[model samples]
Target: PAGAGQDQTFRADDEPEHGDLIVTEAGVLKVLHTPGHASNHLCFLLVDQQLLFSGDHIMQGSTVVINPPDGDMKAYIESLYELLAESVRYIAPAHGFLMGHPEAVIDFLITHRLSREHKVARALGALTPVDLKALTAKAYDDVPAAIHGLAARSALAHLLKLEAEHRAFREGDLWHAIHES
Candidate 1:
Protein backbone atom coordinates (compact mmCIF):
# COMPACT_ATOMS: atom_id res chain seq x y z
CA PRO A 1 0.00 0.00 0.00
CA ALA A 2 1.32 3.45 -0.93
CA GLY A 3 1.51 6.09 1.76
CA ALA A 4 -0.69 9.16 1.39
CA GLY A 5 1.19 12.23 0.17
CA GLN A 6 1.56 15.43 2.22
CA ASP A 7 -1.39 17.05 0.45
CA GLN A 8 -3.70 14.10 1.28
CA THR A 9 -4.04 14.86 4.96
CA PHE A 10 -7.41 13.93 6.45
CA ARG A 11 -9.25 15.75 9.20
CA ALA A 12 -10.50 13.83 12.25
CA ASP A 13 -14.13 14.80 11.66
CA ASP A 14 -14.08 13.52 8.09
CA GLU A 15 -12.42 10.27 9.08
CA PRO A 16 -14.57 7.16 9.15
CA GLU A 17 -14.07 4.92 12.18
CA HIS A 18 -15.37 1.42 12.96
CA GLY A 19 -19.14 0.88 12.89
CA ASP A 20 -19.71 4.23 11.20
CA LEU A 21 -22.83 4.18 9.04
CA ILE A 22 -22.16 6.24 5.96
CA VAL A 23 -25.15 7.05 3.78
CA THR A 24 -24.60 7.55 0.05
CA GLU A 25 -26.75 7.68 -3.10
CA ALA A 26 -25.73 4.13 -3.96
CA GLY A 27 -26.42 2.66 -0.53
CA VAL A 28 -25.20 2.69 3.02
CA LEU A 29 -21.55 1.74 3.21
CA LYS A 30 -20.88 0.47 6.72
CA VAL A 31 -17.30 0.96 7.79
CA LEU A 32 -15.77 -2.02 9.51
CA HIS A 33 -12.33 -1.40 11.00
CA THR A 34 -10.61 -4.69 10.27
CA PRO A 35 -7.00 -4.33 11.26
CA GLY A 36 -4.27 -7.09 11.38
CA HIS A 37 -3.45 -7.36 7.65
CA ALA A 38 -2.21 -3.86 8.39
CA SER A 39 -2.90 -1.73 11.44
CA ASN A 40 -5.58 0.33 9.64
CA HIS A 41 -7.17 -2.17 7.23
CA LEU A 42 -10.88 -1.74 6.57
CA CYS A 43 -13.72 -3.46 4.67
CA PHE A 44 -16.79 -1.61 3.45
CA LEU A 45 -20.20 -3.27 3.33
CA LEU A 46 -22.82 -2.23 0.77
CA VAL A 47 -26.10 -2.42 2.65
CA ASP A 48 -28.33 -2.75 -0.39
CA GLN A 49 -26.59 -5.58 -2.20
CA GLN A 50 -25.06 -7.21 0.90
CA LEU A 51 -21.74 -6.97 -0.89
CA LEU A 52 -18.49 -6.56 1.01
CA PHE A 53 -15.58 -4.61 -0.45
CA SER A 54 -12.91 -6.55 1.38
CA GLY A 55 -9.78 -4.48 0.92
CA ASP A 56 -6.89 -6.87 1.48
CA HIS A 57 -8.45 -8.28 4.61
CA ILE A 58 -9.43 -11.62 3.11
CA MET A 59 -8.18 -12.83 -0.24
CA GLN A 60 -9.43 -15.31 -2.85
CA GLY A 61 -7.97 -18.83 -2.35
CA SER A 62 -4.88 -17.53 -0.58
CA THR A 63 -3.92 -17.09 3.06
CA VAL A 64 -2.91 -13.60 4.14
CA VAL A 65 0.67 -13.31 5.31
CA ILE A 66 0.45 -12.32 8.96
CA ASN A 67 3.57 -10.28 9.55
CA PRO A 68 4.39 -9.24 13.08
CA PRO A 69 3.79 -5.79 14.59
CA ASP A 70 1.59 -4.46 11.77
CA GLY A 71 0.04 -7.90 11.15
CA ASP A 72 -1.33 -9.92 14.08
CA MET A 73 -2.65 -13.49 14.01
CA LYS A 74 -4.99 -12.88 16.92
CA ALA A 75 -6.37 -9.62 15.61
CA TYR A 76 -6.70 -11.05 12.10
CA ILE A 77 -8.69 -14.05 13.34
CA GLU A 78 -10.89 -11.81 15.46
CA SER A 79 -11.59 -9.60 12.47
CA LEU A 80 -12.46 -12.68 10.40
CA TYR A 81 -14.92 -13.87 13.05
CA GLU A 82 -16.39 -10.39 13.29
CA LEU A 83 -16.97 -10.27 9.55
CA LEU A 84 -18.41 -13.81 9.72
CA ALA A 85 -21.10 -12.55 12.12
CA GLU A 86 -22.14 -9.92 9.58
CA SER A 87 -24.62 -10.37 6.71
CA VAL A 88 -22.27 -10.58 3.74
CA ARG A 89 -23.51 -12.37 0.60
CA TYR A 90 -20.73 -11.41 -1.78
CA ILE A 91 -17.12 -10.40 -1.14
CA ALA A 92 -15.28 -8.13 -3.57
CA PRO A 93 -11.64 -8.44 -2.59
CA ALA A 94 -8.99 -5.82 -3.39
CA HIS A 95 -7.39 -8.43 -5.61
CA GLY A 96 -9.06 -11.16 -7.72
CA PHE A 97 -12.74 -11.63 -8.56
CA LEU A 98 -15.80 -11.44 -6.31
CA MET A 99 -16.49 -14.30 -3.84
CA GLY A 100 -20.00 -15.62 -3.34
CA HIS A 101 -19.39 -17.71 -0.20
CA PRO A 102 -18.25 -15.03 2.22
CA GLU A 103 -19.14 -16.87 5.43
CA ALA A 104 -17.45 -20.13 4.35
CA VAL A 105 -14.39 -18.23 3.21
CA ILE A 106 -14.15 -16.29 6.46
CA ASP A 107 -14.66 -19.46 8.49
CA PHE A 108 -12.07 -21.31 6.43
CA LEU A 109 -9.56 -18.51 6.92
CA ILE A 110 -10.13 -18.62 10.66
CA THR A 111 -9.70 -22.40 10.74
CA HIS A 112 -6.58 -22.14 8.62
CA ARG A 113 -4.96 -19.55 10.88
CA LEU A 114 -5.90 -21.49 14.01
CA SER A 115 -4.48 -24.66 12.50
CA ARG A 116 -1.21 -22.87 11.77
CA GLU A 117 -1.16 -21.54 15.30
CA HIS A 118 -1.67 -25.07 16.61
CA LYS A 119 1.23 -26.34 14.51
CA VAL A 120 3.40 -23.58 15.95
CA ALA A 121 2.41 -24.63 19.44
CA ARG A 122 3.17 -28.28 18.72
CA ALA A 123 6.57 -27.35 17.31
CA LEU A 124 7.33 -25.35 20.43
CA GLY A 125 6.14 -28.16 22.62
CA ALA A 126 8.60 -30.49 20.86
CA LEU A 127 11.57 -28.25 21.54
CA THR A 128 12.74 -26.14 24.45
CA PRO A 129 13.70 -22.50 23.77
CA VAL A 130 13.99 -22.35 19.98
CA ASP A 131 14.74 -19.62 17.46
CA LEU A 132 11.98 -18.59 15.04
CA LYS A 133 13.67 -20.14 11.98
CA ALA A 134 13.88 -23.63 13.52
CA LEU A 135 10.24 -23.47 14.64
CA THR A 136 9.14 -22.29 11.20
CA ALA A 137 11.02 -25.11 9.50
CA LYS A 138 9.45 -27.70 11.76
CA ALA A 139 5.93 -26.25 11.94
CA TYR A 140 5.50 -25.06 8.39
CA ASP A 141 7.23 -27.89 6.48
CA ASP A 142 4.17 -27.83 4.24
CA VAL A 143 5.36 -24.45 2.92
CA PRO A 144 8.20 -24.13 0.44
CA ALA A 145 11.72 -23.19 1.56
CA ALA A 146 11.79 -20.12 -0.72
CA ILE A 147 8.97 -18.57 1.31
CA HIS A 148 10.28 -19.74 4.70
CA GLY A 149 11.72 -16.27 5.21
CA LEU A 150 8.20 -14.91 4.99
CA ALA A 151 6.87 -17.90 6.96
CA ALA A 152 9.39 -17.14 9.72
CA ARG A 153 7.81 -13.75 10.25
CA SER A 154 4.36 -15.33 10.34
CA ALA A 155 5.72 -17.88 12.85
CA LEU A 156 7.04 -15.02 14.94
CA ALA A 157 3.54 -13.56 14.90
CA HIS A 158 2.23 -16.89 16.22
CA LEU A 159 4.89 -16.93 18.92
CA LEU A 160 3.90 -13.40 19.88
CA LYS A 161 0.27 -14.52 20.06
CA LEU A 162 1.25 -17.49 22.22
CA GLU A 163 3.31 -15.18 24.43
CA ALA A 164 0.32 -12.82 24.75
CA GLU A 165 -1.76 -15.75 25.95
CA HIS A 166 1.05 -16.77 28.37
CA ARG A 167 1.39 -20.08 26.54
CA ALA A 168 4.95 -19.17 25.52
CA PHE A 169 7.77 -16.88 26.63
CA ARG A 170 10.55 -15.01 24.89
CA GLU A 171 14.08 -14.97 26.25
CA GLY A 172 16.00 -12.68 23.88
CA ASP A 173 15.45 -13.99 20.30
CA LEU A 174 14.82 -17.56 21.48
CA TRP A 175 11.27 -18.46 22.51
CA HIS A 176 10.40 -20.93 25.28
CA ALA A 177 7.15 -22.81 25.68
CA ILE A 178 5.24 -22.15 28.90
CA HIS A 179 3.41 -25.21 30.10
CA GLU A 180 0.98 -24.65 32.95
CA SER A 181 1.00 -27.26 35.72
Candidate 2:
Protein backbone atom coordinates (compact mmCIF):
# COMPACT_ATOMS: atom_id res chain seq x y z
CA PRO A 1 0.00 0.00 0.00
CA ALA A 2 3.07 2.15 -0.26
CA GLY A 3 2.33 4.76 -2.91
CA ALA A 4 5.83 4.79 -4.28
CA GLY A 5 6.40 7.15 -7.21
CA GLN A 6 2.93 8.60 -6.67
CA ASP A 7 4.45 11.91 -5.74
CA GLN A 8 7.34 12.30 -8.16
CA THR A 9 7.21 16.06 -7.78
CA PHE A 10 8.67 15.87 -4.29
CA ARG A 11 12.42 16.29 -4.11
CA ALA A 12 14.84 16.16 -1.22
CA ASP A 13 16.83 19.36 -0.78
CA ASP A 14 19.44 17.70 1.45
CA GLU A 15 20.33 14.15 2.38
CA PRO A 16 21.02 13.83 6.09
CA GLU A 17 23.26 11.04 7.34
CA HIS A 18 23.26 9.35 10.71
CA GLY A 19 24.55 11.54 13.57
CA ASP A 20 24.06 14.67 11.45
CA LEU A 21 22.34 17.54 13.20
CA ILE A 22 19.84 19.91 11.66
CA VAL A 23 18.91 23.06 13.53
CA THR A 24 15.23 23.94 13.35
CA GLU A 25 12.91 26.34 15.15
CA ALA A 26 11.64 23.57 17.39
CA GLY A 27 15.07 22.23 18.21
CA VAL A 28 18.19 20.61 16.84
CA LEU A 29 17.28 17.31 15.19
CA LYS A 30 19.78 14.48 15.29
CA VAL A 31 19.50 12.13 12.35
CA LEU A 32 19.44 8.43 13.14
CA HIS A 33 19.75 5.98 10.26
CA THR A 34 17.44 3.19 11.31
CA PRO A 35 17.31 0.56 8.61
CA GLY A 36 15.06 -2.47 9.00
CA HIS A 37 11.53 -1.78 7.81
CA ALA A 38 13.28 -0.15 4.88
CA SER A 39 16.94 0.31 3.99
CA ASN A 40 16.63 4.08 3.78
CA HIS A 41 14.52 4.59 6.89
CA LEU A 42 15.59 7.47 9.13
CA CYS A 43 14.49 8.66 12.57
CA PHE A 44 14.95 12.20 13.71
CA LEU A 45 15.59 13.03 17.35
CA LEU A 46 14.72 16.40 18.83
CA VAL A 47 17.83 16.79 20.98
CA ASP A 48 16.63 19.67 23.09
CA GLN A 49 13.18 18.21 23.74
CA GLN A 50 14.43 14.63 24.15
CA LEU A 51 11.85 13.53 21.62
CA LEU A 52 12.37 10.94 18.92
CA PHE A 53 10.55 10.91 15.59
CA SER A 54 10.58 7.16 15.01
CA GLY A 55 9.11 7.15 11.51
CA ASP A 56 8.47 3.52 10.42
CA HIS A 57 10.96 2.04 12.87
CA ILE A 58 8.44 1.90 15.67
CA MET A 59 4.66 2.24 15.33
CA GLN A 60 1.92 2.74 17.89
CA GLY A 61 -0.45 -0.08 17.03
CA SER A 62 1.62 -2.69 15.20
CA THR A 63 5.13 -4.02 14.84
CA VAL A 64 7.08 -2.85 11.84
CA VAL A 65 7.48 -5.43 9.04
CA ILE A 66 10.92 -6.67 8.13
CA ASN A 67 10.65 -7.95 4.58
CA PRO A 68 13.95 -9.42 3.37
CA PRO A 69 16.47 -8.03 0.92
CA ASP A 70 15.69 -4.49 2.05
CA GLY A 71 14.43 -5.33 5.53
CA ASP A 72 17.03 -6.82 7.87
CA MET A 73 15.78 -8.24 11.14
CA LYS A 74 19.26 -8.21 12.65
CA ALA A 75 19.73 -4.60 11.70
CA TYR A 76 16.26 -3.79 13.01
CA ILE A 77 17.07 -5.23 16.43
CA GLU A 78 20.46 -3.55 16.49
CA SER A 79 18.89 -0.22 15.61
CA LEU A 80 16.51 -0.55 18.54
CA TYR A 81 19.46 -1.12 20.84
CA GLU A 82 21.12 1.93 19.36
CA LEU A 83 18.16 4.05 20.36
CA LEU A 84 18.58 2.95 23.96
CA ALA A 85 21.86 4.87 23.99
CA GLU A 86 20.05 8.07 23.13
CA SER A 87 18.43 10.30 25.72
CA VAL A 88 14.85 10.13 24.53
CA ARG A 89 11.90 10.61 26.83
CA TYR A 90 9.12 10.48 24.26
CA ILE A 91 8.49 8.91 20.89
CA ALA A 92 6.61 10.54 18.03
CA PRO A 93 5.91 7.63 15.77
CA ALA A 94 4.92 8.30 12.21
CA HIS A 95 1.77 6.17 12.39
CA GLY A 96 0.76 6.55 16.02
CA PHE A 97 0.16 8.95 18.87
CA LEU A 98 3.02 10.33 20.90
CA MET A 99 4.30 7.89 23.47
CA GLY A 100 6.07 8.43 26.81
CA HIS A 101 8.85 6.34 28.37
CA PRO A 102 10.86 5.91 25.18
CA GLU A 103 13.29 3.50 26.80
CA ALA A 104 10.48 1.26 27.95
CA VAL A 105 8.95 1.31 24.49
CA ILE A 106 12.26 0.37 22.89
CA ASP A 107 12.81 -2.40 25.39
CA PHE A 108 9.34 -3.82 24.78
CA LEU A 109 9.80 -3.86 21.02
CA ILE A 110 13.21 -5.53 21.29
CA THR A 111 11.97 -8.11 23.76
CA HIS A 112 8.92 -8.88 21.66
CA ARG A 113 11.00 -9.37 18.52
CA LEU A 114 13.49 -11.61 20.35
CA SER A 115 10.66 -13.62 21.85
CA ARG A 116 9.21 -14.13 18.36
CA GLU A 117 12.66 -15.14 17.17
CA HIS A 118 12.83 -17.71 19.92
CA LYS A 119 9.48 -19.07 18.81
CA VAL A 120 10.77 -19.29 15.26
CA ALA A 121 13.84 -21.20 16.49
CA ARG A 122 11.69 -23.60 18.46
CA ALA A 123 9.48 -24.15 15.46
CA LEU A 124 12.55 -24.76 13.33
CA GLY A 125 13.89 -27.31 15.80
CA ALA A 126 10.58 -29.15 15.83
CA LEU A 127 9.97 -28.91 12.10
CA THR A 128 13.42 -29.19 10.65
CA PRO A 129 13.73 -29.79 6.92
CA VAL A 130 10.42 -27.98 6.49
CA ASP A 131 9.49 -25.32 3.97
CA LEU A 132 8.96 -21.66 4.87
CA LYS A 133 5.16 -21.89 4.71
CA ALA A 134 4.94 -24.88 7.04
CA LEU A 135 7.50 -23.37 9.44
CA THR A 136 5.62 -20.10 9.59
CA ALA A 137 2.44 -21.93 10.53
CA LYS A 138 4.18 -23.59 13.45
CA ALA A 139 6.05 -20.52 14.66
CA TYR A 140 3.18 -18.06 14.33
CA ASP A 141 0.45 -20.29 15.68
CA ASP A 142 -0.28 -17.65 18.31
CA VAL A 143 -1.53 -15.22 15.67
CA PRO A 144 -4.63 -15.46 13.51
CA ALA A 145 -4.36 -17.68 10.44
CA ALA A 146 -5.54 -14.90 8.12
CA ILE A 147 -2.24 -13.01 8.53
CA HIS A 148 0.09 -15.97 8.08
CA GLY A 149 1.17 -14.64 4.73
CA LEU A 150 2.53 -11.50 6.35
CA ALA A 151 3.84 -13.51 9.27
CA ALA A 152 5.83 -15.66 6.87
CA ARG A 153 7.75 -12.60 5.74
CA SER A 154 8.79 -11.79 9.31
CA ALA A 155 9.54 -15.45 9.95
CA LEU A 156 11.84 -15.52 6.99
CA ALA A 157 13.59 -12.48 8.33
CA HIS A 158 14.07 -14.22 11.65
CA LEU A 159 15.37 -17.34 9.93
CA LEU A 160 17.85 -15.21 8.02
CA LYS A 161 19.07 -13.77 11.27
CA LEU A 162 19.42 -17.22 12.74
CA GLU A 163 21.33 -18.34 9.69
CA ALA A 164 23.67 -15.40 10.07
CA GLU A 165 24.32 -16.49 13.65
CA HIS A 166 25.08 -20.05 12.48
CA ARG A 167 21.99 -21.39 14.17
CA ALA A 168 20.01 -22.33 11.04
CA PHE A 169 20.50 -23.25 7.41
CA ARG A 170 18.41 -23.67 4.28
CA GLU A 171 18.58 -26.24 1.54
CA GLY A 172 16.58 -25.33 -1.55
CA ASP A 173 13.08 -24.52 -0.28
CA LEU A 174 13.55 -26.38 2.99
CA TRP A 175 15.07 -24.98 6.18
CA HIS A 176 17.10 -26.95 8.72
CA ALA A 177 18.25 -26.08 12.22
CA ILE A 178 21.93 -26.46 13.00
CA HIS A 179 22.22 -28.32 16.26
CA GLU A 180 25.33 -27.75 18.30
CA SER A 181 27.12 -30.74 19.76
Candidate 3:
Protein backbone atom coordinates (compact mmCIF):
# COMPACT_ATOMS: atom_id res chain seq x y z
CA PRO A 1 0.00 0.00 0.00
CA ALA A 2 1.09 3.61 -0.63
CA GLY A 3 2.07 5.76 2.35
CA ALA A 4 2.87 9.33 3.35
CA GLY A 5 5.81 10.30 5.57
CA GLN A 6 6.01 12.43 8.71
CA ASP A 7 5.08 16.11 8.55
CA GLN A 8 7.94 18.51 7.82
CA THR A 9 8.09 22.08 6.54
CA PHE A 10 9.99 21.18 3.36
CA ARG A 11 10.21 17.96 1.32
CA ALA A 12 11.42 15.54 3.91
CA ASP A 13 14.49 13.52 2.99
CA ASP A 14 13.31 10.67 5.18
CA GLU A 15 10.46 10.05 2.71
CA PRO A 16 10.68 6.72 0.97
CA GLU A 17 11.43 6.59 -2.73
CA HIS A 18 8.83 4.50 -4.57
CA GLY A 19 11.01 3.60 -7.54
CA ASP A 20 11.45 5.93 -10.53
CA LEU A 21 9.12 3.63 -12.48
CA ILE A 22 6.13 1.58 -11.40
CA VAL A 23 5.13 -1.46 -13.45
CA THR A 24 1.62 -2.81 -13.13
CA GLU A 25 -0.84 -4.91 -15.14
CA ALA A 26 -1.63 -1.82 -17.17
CA GLY A 27 1.87 -0.75 -18.24
CA VAL A 28 5.15 0.77 -17.12
CA LEU A 29 4.35 4.21 -15.73
CA LYS A 30 7.05 6.86 -15.37
CA VAL A 31 6.75 9.09 -12.30
CA LEU A 32 7.14 12.78 -12.99
CA HIS A 33 7.61 15.09 -10.03
CA THR A 34 5.45 18.16 -10.59
CA PRO A 35 5.85 19.99 -7.27
CA GLY A 36 3.91 23.24 -6.94
CA HIS A 37 0.52 22.78 -5.33
CA ALA A 38 2.54 20.95 -2.70
CA SER A 39 6.13 19.84 -2.62
CA ASN A 40 4.84 16.29 -2.95
CA HIS A 41 2.83 16.88 -6.16
CA LEU A 42 3.27 14.29 -8.89
CA CYS A 43 2.15 13.41 -12.43
CA PHE A 44 2.37 10.01 -14.03
CA LEU A 45 2.80 9.02 -17.64
CA LEU A 46 1.20 5.84 -18.94
CA VAL A 47 3.86 4.23 -21.12
CA ASP A 48 1.52 2.28 -23.37
CA GLN A 49 -1.00 5.00 -24.29
CA GLN A 50 1.11 8.14 -23.57
CA LEU A 51 -1.67 9.26 -21.24
CA LEU A 52 -0.84 11.70 -18.43
CA PHE A 53 -2.33 11.47 -14.96
CA SER A 54 -2.30 15.12 -13.88
CA GLY A 55 -2.97 15.05 -10.16
CA ASP A 56 -4.29 18.51 -9.18
CA HIS A 57 -1.96 20.28 -11.61
CA ILE A 58 -4.29 20.62 -14.56
CA MET A 59 -7.78 20.20 -13.24
CA GLN A 60 -10.77 20.24 -15.60
CA GLY A 61 -12.86 22.46 -13.36
CA SER A 62 -11.63 25.33 -11.16
CA THR A 63 -8.02 26.42 -11.42
CA VAL A 64 -5.80 25.35 -8.55
CA VAL A 65 -3.99 28.15 -6.79
CA ILE A 66 -0.22 27.87 -6.37
CA ASN A 67 -0.08 27.90 -2.56
CA PRO A 68 3.23 29.43 -1.46
CA PRO A 69 5.73 28.97 1.41
CA ASP A 70 5.68 25.35 0.27
CA GLY A 71 4.29 25.91 -3.24
CA ASP A 72 6.56 28.27 -5.14
CA MET A 73 4.95 30.38 -7.87
CA LYS A 74 8.16 30.24 -9.90
CA ALA A 75 8.25 26.47 -9.62
CA TYR A 76 4.55 26.20 -10.48
CA ILE A 77 5.06 28.30 -13.63
CA GLU A 78 8.01 26.15 -14.60
CA SER A 79 5.99 23.01 -13.94
CA LEU A 80 3.25 24.22 -16.31
CA TYR A 81 5.84 24.74 -19.02
CA GLU A 82 7.24 21.31 -18.33
CA LEU A 83 3.77 19.78 -18.72
CA LEU A 84 3.34 21.57 -22.03
CA ALA A 85 6.68 20.19 -23.23
CA GLU A 86 5.59 16.61 -22.66
CA SER A 87 3.92 14.60 -25.44
CA VAL A 88 0.45 13.53 -24.34
CA ARG A 89 -3.02 13.51 -25.84
CA TYR A 90 -5.04 12.58 -22.75
CA ILE A 91 -5.01 14.20 -19.29
CA ALA A 92 -6.81 12.49 -16.40
CA PRO A 93 -6.68 14.85 -13.43
CA ALA A 94 -7.36 14.06 -9.79
CA HIS A 95 -10.28 16.48 -9.74
CA GLY A 96 -12.95 16.86 -12.42
CA PHE A 97 -13.09 14.97 -15.76
CA LEU A 98 -10.48 14.62 -18.48
CA MET A 99 -9.15 17.78 -20.03
CA GLY A 100 -10.22 17.96 -23.69
CA HIS A 101 -8.24 21.10 -24.44
CA PRO A 102 -4.95 20.99 -22.58
CA GLU A 103 -3.35 23.93 -24.38
CA ALA A 104 -6.34 26.16 -23.75
CA VAL A 105 -6.37 25.26 -20.07
CA ILE A 106 -2.66 25.94 -19.81
CA ASP A 107 -3.07 29.29 -21.54
CA PHE A 108 -5.97 30.21 -19.29
CA LEU A 109 -3.94 29.38 -16.18
CA ILE A 110 -0.93 31.38 -17.34
CA THR A 111 -3.09 34.34 -18.33
CA HIS A 112 -4.97 34.17 -15.07
CA ARG A 113 -1.75 34.47 -13.08
CA LEU A 114 -0.49 37.32 -15.25
CA SER A 115 -3.84 39.06 -14.75
CA ARG A 116 -3.47 38.73 -11.00
CA GLU A 117 0.00 40.25 -11.22
CA HIS A 118 -1.52 43.14 -13.15
CA LYS A 119 -4.19 43.58 -10.54
CA VAL A 120 -1.46 43.75 -7.90
CA ALA A 121 0.36 46.33 -9.97
CA ARG A 122 -2.78 48.44 -10.30
CA ALA A 123 -3.44 48.12 -6.61
CA LEU A 124 0.08 49.31 -5.91
CA GLY A 125 -0.52 52.39 -8.10
CA ALA A 126 -3.89 53.41 -6.66
CA LEU A 127 -3.18 53.20 -2.96
CA THR A 128 -0.59 54.12 -0.35
CA PRO A 129 0.24 52.41 2.94
CA VAL A 130 -2.03 49.38 2.33
CA ASP A 131 -1.90 46.48 4.72
CA LEU A 132 -2.11 42.81 3.68
CA LYS A 133 -5.73 42.65 4.79
CA ALA A 134 -6.80 45.79 2.89
CA LEU A 135 -4.90 45.05 -0.32
CA THR A 136 -6.09 41.47 -0.30
CA ALA A 137 -9.65 42.63 0.27
CA LYS A 138 -9.62 44.85 -2.82
CA ALA A 139 -7.66 42.42 -4.94
CA TYR A 140 -9.92 39.51 -4.12
CA ASP A 141 -13.16 41.36 -3.36
CA ASP A 142 -15.01 39.14 -5.82
CA VAL A 143 -14.53 36.16 -3.52
CA PRO A 144 -16.86 35.63 -0.56
CA ALA A 145 -15.89 37.19 2.77
CA ALA A 146 -15.86 33.81 4.44
CA ILE A 147 -12.94 32.69 2.25
CA HIS A 148 -11.26 36.07 2.38
CA GLY A 149 -8.62 34.78 4.74
CA LEU A 150 -7.48 32.24 2.18
CA ALA A 151 -7.61 34.93 -0.48
CA ALA A 152 -5.47 37.09 1.75
CA ARG A 153 -3.01 34.26 2.03
CA SER A 154 -2.81 33.99 -1.76
CA ALA A 155 -2.48 37.75 -2.06
CA LEU A 156 0.28 37.65 0.55
CA ALA A 157 1.91 34.90 -1.47
CA HIS A 158 2.01 37.24 -4.45
CA LEU A 159 3.30 40.05 -2.28
CA LEU A 160 6.05 37.91 -0.85
CA LYS A 161 7.12 36.81 -4.31
CA LEU A 162 7.03 40.37 -5.60
CA GLU A 163 9.02 41.58 -2.62
CA ALA A 164 11.67 38.96 -3.21
CA GLU A 165 11.93 40.18 -6.82
CA HIS A 166 12.32 43.79 -5.52
CA ARG A 167 9.00 44.83 -7.08
CA ALA A 168 7.37 45.44 -3.69
CA PHE A 169 8.21 46.03 -0.04
CA ARG A 170 6.45 45.39 3.24
CA GLU A 171 6.25 47.76 6.19
CA GLY A 172 4.87 45.95 9.23
CA ASP A 173 1.70 44.21 7.85
CA LEU A 174 1.41 46.53 4.87
CA TRP A 175 3.00 46.20 1.40
CA HIS A 176 3.93 49.23 -0.66
CA ALA A 177 5.16 49.49 -4.24
CA ILE A 178 8.91 50.17 -4.37
CA HIS A 179 8.58 53.10 -6.76
CA GLU A 180 6.43 55.25 -4.45
CA SER A 181 9.20 57.43 -3.09
Best by TM-score: 2
Estimate, for each residue in 44-156, the C-alpha lDDT of model 3 and write its tens digit. Answer: 88868778899887787787766677766656666887878767778898998877666767878878876887787678656746887888778877789898788776777
TM-scores of all models? 0.92, 0.94, 0.79
Query: Which pairs in model 2 have colliding backbones?
Result: none
lDDT string, candidate 1, 1-181, tens digits: 4346644565456778999999999899999999888888889999889999998998887878788788888888889989988899999998888999887888888888889999999999897689888999999999899999999989998998898899999988888999889
Off-target runs (Cα >4 Å) in candidate 3 are 1-19
lDDT of 3 at 22: 80
- Superposed on all Cα atoms, model 3 deviates from the true structure by an RMSD in Å of 4.6
Lowest summed lDDT across 10 adjacent residues in model 1 is found at 1-10
For model 1, the superposed segments whose C-alpha errors exceed 4 Å read 1-13
Q: Which stretches of candidate 2 lie over 4 Å from their true place?
A: 1-11
Q: Give me the displacement of residue 135 in model 2, in angstroms.
A: 0.3
| Model 2 TM | 0.94
Scanning candidate 3 in windows of ten residues, the lowest lDDT window is: 10-19
